[model samples]
Target: MENKMNRRGFFAAMGKFMGLAAVAPAVLGGVFSNQANAQEKRRSAGPGASAVAGSMVDVNDPIAKAVKYVEDFQKSPASKGNKCATCGFYAKKEMHGATEVGTCTIFAGKLVNANGFCASWNKKA
Candidate 1:
């Protein structure tokens, strides 16, 4: 009877171990995958992304071209009276080189000179 009891106990423990073994890899893989994704985000978020600075949009960028974005307001006659800083779509102003830059809603994830003007400009309320 004792022998039978010991065998049953061992089998129970073995069954539990097997269950854990089967499930452990999947759980651990998910944990590691999440960590990797988070690390990638942090790594890719370096220079181009900052609380004060963002990736600046170039005049030649597709969106910039579509919106007729001009780094200098004077360059675009229609943009003469408008400035990005006064625009409803611009925010997060930070100094970049000699001029201040801000993020424009029309050009997500990028910065535009505070003096820059775009066709999408709207007077800030």
Candidate 2:
């Protein structure tokens, strides 16, 4: 009877441990998903999205002359030269309402039209 009791106790402990182990991943996944959702919500609710959307400039605007310069340069003998991807002002991913535009760090509130170029263009170090 003592031996049977010991075996039952061992099995009970293992069952409890296995149950907790199975639940651990689900619990962690829930926590991470919640955190990601919160961050996304915060970003969409903030000024960054609104600011970019409202301040977007036309690709043909004179203010976007630099954008044109980059395009022209790309076709010239300097085709191998600088590009938005290599520039400091280039925003790799689209944000806010500037889907085709790259956010220029130097332009502050303004996002550079992806097709736009500027004198501030620099090669990525």
Number of colliding residue pairs in each model: 0, 3
Model 1 weakest lDDT span, ten residues long: 44-53
Model 1, runs deviating above 4 Å: 1-53
User: Cα deviation of 94 in candidate 2 (Å)?
Assistant: 2.0
Candidate 2 lDDT at 40 equals: 89
Q: What is the C-alpha RMSD of each candidate to the true structure, in Å?
A: 9.1, 10.2
Question: Evaluated with TM-score, which candidate comes out highest?
Answer: 1
CA error at residue 90 for candidate 2, angstroms: 2.0
Per-residue lDDT over 12-120 for candidate 1, one digit per residue giving the tens place of the 0 to 100 score: 9999999999999999999999999978865654543444345788999998999999998988999868988899887745576778887777877688988899899
Model 2, 57-125: lDDT tens per residue?
554667566544444345544445656656765664454453465556755555555644556677766
- Point to the candidate with the largest lDDT: 1
lDDT of each: 0.82, 0.62
